[model samples]
Target: MKNVSDEELMILVSNGNLDMMSILFDRYHVRIYNFLLKMTRDQDVSQDITQEVFYKVLKYRTSYKKGKFSSWIYTIARNVFSDHYQKQKNKDQRLNDIHYKTIGQETNSVDDEEIKEQLHLALMKLSHSDRELIIMNRYQGIKYQEIAEIMDSTEGAVKTKVHRAIHKLKEYYLQKI
Candidate 1:
């Protein structure tokens, strides 16, 4: 099962091999959670949105196409986040309350922690789309081609967007410093 590609697992799940869904979940759940966490900056909301993403995969399993499964799953996750954002917008909820949690390392220095927190705040100050673009490219290490596919844009356009997003993030980070 570990040797099976994500696309194959998705196809099997789509074909009624329900157990394959778990495999897909195991493969992508953390990445999806981290993606959502960076976007929403809320642990609980990220968890809920991650669950919704998988539920959507199950609900729309039959619609799976033969392509990069990462792109397809990311597309679904993007849609889920958009829907959640819209609802929050209608409710007048603030989306900028990003509390940055250290994801993988323990910082030993106070200055380092402060710098990380400031950087996180700067990232949160970016527009939602820009923040997502940076997170997907920089943090999650998704390819430009796959991001373009999920975004329904040309690879060149995705590259340009990512470049601009990085520039904007840099400006913001510099301003904070």
Candidate 2:
């Protein structure tokens, strides 16, 4: 499992290698949880959905038949989140549910932290779709092609949407609200 690709591991899982699923879970659970946390701004809900994502992965293991394993898993996570969001439209949220840092940076400066906090606020200002694009593209480091795969769109379209989302984020950040 350590040397195997995600696709191979998932294929093994699909073929009754249930134990191998743990390796996949170990690799992905944090990422899936973080993704959901960013979307929901609720730790408890994110944890619940992250668990459900893995549960669905095992339950629908037979349905996974190829292409990028990461993409498939993200698709499932996104769908699960959508279902949950639809069911619980009035999910509780704090005014500040997240603190964001710049990509690969430790902000020790007060100025930097302030900027990052403002960026987080700006991020919250965007529509859910735009914010999702930013999170997947920038925060999670998911490439446009893979996002396109998870989003069921073309790479070019994903790139354009992400660009627009970034533009919107910039606009909101400039507002400094």
Q: How close is candidate 2 to the true structure, as a TM-score?
A: 0.86
lDDT of 1 by residue, 65-148 (tens): 888999999999999999999898888876864344556668789899888788887888788888999999999999999899
TM-score of 1: 0.93
Best by TM-score: 1
**lDDT scores for all predictions?**
0.90, 0.87
In the range 1-177, model 2's lDDT, one tens digit per residue, is: 488999999999999999999999999999999898787766777889999999999999999987799999999999998888766655653333433233455767989779877887788889878988999989899999999999999999999999999999999999885
TM-score of each: 0.93, 0.86
Off by over 4 Å in 1: 97-106
- lDDT of residue 79 for candidate 1: 96
Candidate 2 whole-model C-alpha lDDT, 0 to 1 = 0.87
